[model samples]
Target: MFPAEQTLQLRALDPEDNRIETSAGIFVVEGSAFDEGLEAVAIDSWGTSSCALDAYSAGDVADLGDGETFTLNADGTYIWQGDDDQISGRAQRFFFTATIPPDFTLSNYDQVLLDEKNSEGMAKAFFNTLTVVIPATIILILIAAFAAYALAWMKFPGRALLVATVVGLLVVPLQLALIPLLTFHVGAMELLTSVMGTVDEDSKLTSVNWFGNWFGMSEGEKIAGKGYFGAWLAHTGFGLPLAIYLLRHYMVGLPRDIIENASVDGATEFQIFTKIILPLSFPALASFAIFQFLWTWNDLLVALVFLIDSSGNTTVMTKQIVELLGTRGGDWEILATSAFVSIAVPLLVFFMMQKYLVRGLLAGSVK
Candidate 1:
């Protein structure tokens, strides 16, 4: 089978067949009629060549001979299968001086992305991650920009303490916040549901199901549940420290004279911030946006704790890949395909926004 089209031949060995010889391995064909149709078996190994023994069972292979050559046991045992009990004793042992040919196929990727049976397909997880990441990043940027601007320019009691507290929160490991935040989310939801429960049918609050409608809930859908809203808030809390720190530092560097001049020209603080500071601070915002986007996109722990519900509807890419590891760990092809799909979006995002990232970091660090 080395040439793929070659016919198998069986021939009587020379009288010297009893002698121990060095040659490309041996083939022992065991069907009762195997010897009738086969002629002399000659393995041509004289030339420098590489081949694979595609027929070797796990332990059948013993050793590799010198370069471009191999050896096999010249003696072979043939079992005659006379009964159903003998089926397990039958095997064809073939040793060939060959190497495994490389096989490349796109079927792995096709299965991972296109096959719905493949753990509900990665497409669902891709969208779930995007849903969690985009809103979380946007919310964090909007909230953090306000907080950072206020910290940079606004004066008030305990301002230094607030900045220090935000900076201090950055050092706190996210692991510590996991359980407490989850409890808080669950408790808060329970409280909201309880409050809504007390409202009568005729109450103005219940007239339009404002809470449910605000959360985009469908008919009979409860407001207390795992979804994008909670995940967005969780990520915002985790990301705010760094976001505020970076934007606050960057905004602080803007020329004070411009702010003073704008104030002198009858521009309100809100107008100056909207018209001047926000545009000027874009590099910082974009930088944090990329960071938060990538972080939230690749996140697994937070999603697992906050977003993934009991019904498994909201799994993200990281969790999806982990599930692949658990279920198809032996399937390397599937694993590779899933992993590649999971990382592709982040890689695309990073490359596309790399300029802003570099500019943002350098801009903050330098001035």
Candidate 2:
């Protein structure tokens, strides 16, 4: 468009002779302005079109339709004998088109699986999901293990009420707590920052922020309850009810004599939990681990509320896949590839932890 009125024309012939007409290239580099469609394939391997007039013998001419013929000079100038002005020495950007044969008539795995932006690959989201899930699962299991041991064996004030509350929470929907928990996370962070961090001239706290208008999006925007740690805590809270309940059931089934002997031998609660109870509860731990991992890995709503920020740095796989489907809805082959890629980890976890699945699910049924 540098010439304003004159236009660059382009066409392509695929390897299968599919003449492609919808293609153009915008040269942002110094080499050429006569290439949008031509180098899109070069930049990202998305072969939009193949120019029809690219082949020529050493001393022979290739006919460019419309009475045009191009020459490649020794200095690499594209000299053309056509009605339009020559583009051999321009430094400005312009659009160009050609009809060379395309390198591919059909795309392979490379095109669908790998790209510059990784639109279909979803790599960023995949690893972000792992970041959220693994630590969250660990924290859930550790806390639940101790609480389950206390609820099952030790007597304390309101212990029965705690058990009843946990059982009642099993039937409560997690969605109901989202807003309140988000508020609590923000309030706690604000309190911590007020105590531990100084206020600057800009009125921003110097502490690691949870939810504040750091981006200047608005005076009221929140950021605290939407990060990895927040996601970890959210998943942990949402998962704790089942984890504690299930673990308590399993721990209750453990031999009474073993725990009694450990106590009689002067074993502290912590010692008993680590040395005696943990080894005996491996199956239950893994069973809860499988549940927590699977839930956190596939979760979208909690991630959206608790993990994802405007920066998209903490996007999980489900959210990323939703984006892929929305943006590339036309590419069914790529969509299929993405589907397979997304489910791979969950499937592997299921198969690897299948043995513990039954034990965990049926923990308290018989007793």
Candidate 3:
């Protein structure tokens, strides 16, 4: 249905086999006749210099008698002549519509399935992130709440030093601990496997080959330095300190009067935390969830160092998008669609939790 036009003066033709050759000039064809099945076509100027159209099918260049009236089988056009027209010496251009075949199926089913599978992979990545985030959030909130309560109230010795140590650790860069942590993880995994008698004395369990036989993954598809468990543990460890610190700050700000009243009611510290503090800390919890979810969802470096394999079974959305760029970079539509797919889940999580992030949730409970 797409319409187009091309206009050029008649030029000389060069006899180069069966293909019609055009001179170094421009030609324009404006007609309702455009067929996609046509084969080879060429345009030439009055001089012997000629050029052939870039696109030519086998059936397009069939002999149409004396060559003055040749039939174009396709809707798409090609430019035979270069920028300079030999006859006119002016800029030359060729334009034609891309003909869609009557029987040609526009819908590519295989491509659709490929797209669906990619989407499924993205969903899996989101699920994996959630697996990491939810447990980490709950643990962090509980520990931070207890620490904050103790630092603010419980009259414990060395409270200031403990709080100071937590605050100091916040400034420590995570990158510094990468090597030591990886080594520890490898050693710990091996130690556990040995104690469980999972490996024989002759069959040593190297970190690189650990997941190979266990998960039945090929060498290229292996998570060489760190396995899935290692990545999960790494995420937990890296997230724990900051989580405890921030949550402690928020929980420490709670009013002391509530705690005292709960105590007067014969409530234990655990009872107060379970019944009162947790419900009151929803806003802070939600805020931290947003941060952690966003960080973990978009994380490529951590996933790359820990999760990806050569066969791409463990590969996450970020790595898949990068690989897509290398393979399908020219396809703008696919690239945009895939990028949006990667971000969709994180956006949904943020919107879902935004209501709990209201500032006044803790107002009445606190001073």
Which candidate leads the pack in lDDT? Answer: 1
Candidate 3, run of 10 with poorest lDDT? 40-49
The C-alpha local distance difference test score for the whole of candidate 2 amounts to 0.65
Candidate 1 residue 207 C-alpha distance from true site, Å = 12
Measured with C-alpha atoms, the lDDT of residue 358 in candidate 1 is 85
Give a tens-digit lDDT track for model 2, residues 229-283.
7888999999999999989988989999998998999999889989989998988
Number of the candidate with higher TM-score, 1 or 3: 1
lDDT, model 1, position 131 = 90
Q: Each model's C-alpha lDDT?
A: 0.67, 0.65, 0.55
Q: Candidate 2: how large is its RMSD? A: 12.8
lDDT of 3: 0.55
- Over the full model, what C-alpha lDDT does candidate 1 score relative to the true structure? 0.67
Model 3, position 102, has a per-residue lDDT of 33
- Quote the lDDT for 211 in model 2: 37
lDDT of 1 by residue, 102-177 (tens): 4577887877767677647477888888899989999999999999989999889999999999999999999999
Count the clashes in each prediction: 9, 18, 26
Give Cα distance to truth, residue 220, candidate 1, Å.
Answer: 5.4
List the candidate 3 regions with Cα displacement exceeding 4 Å: 1-120, 123-126, 201-225, 328-333, 360-367
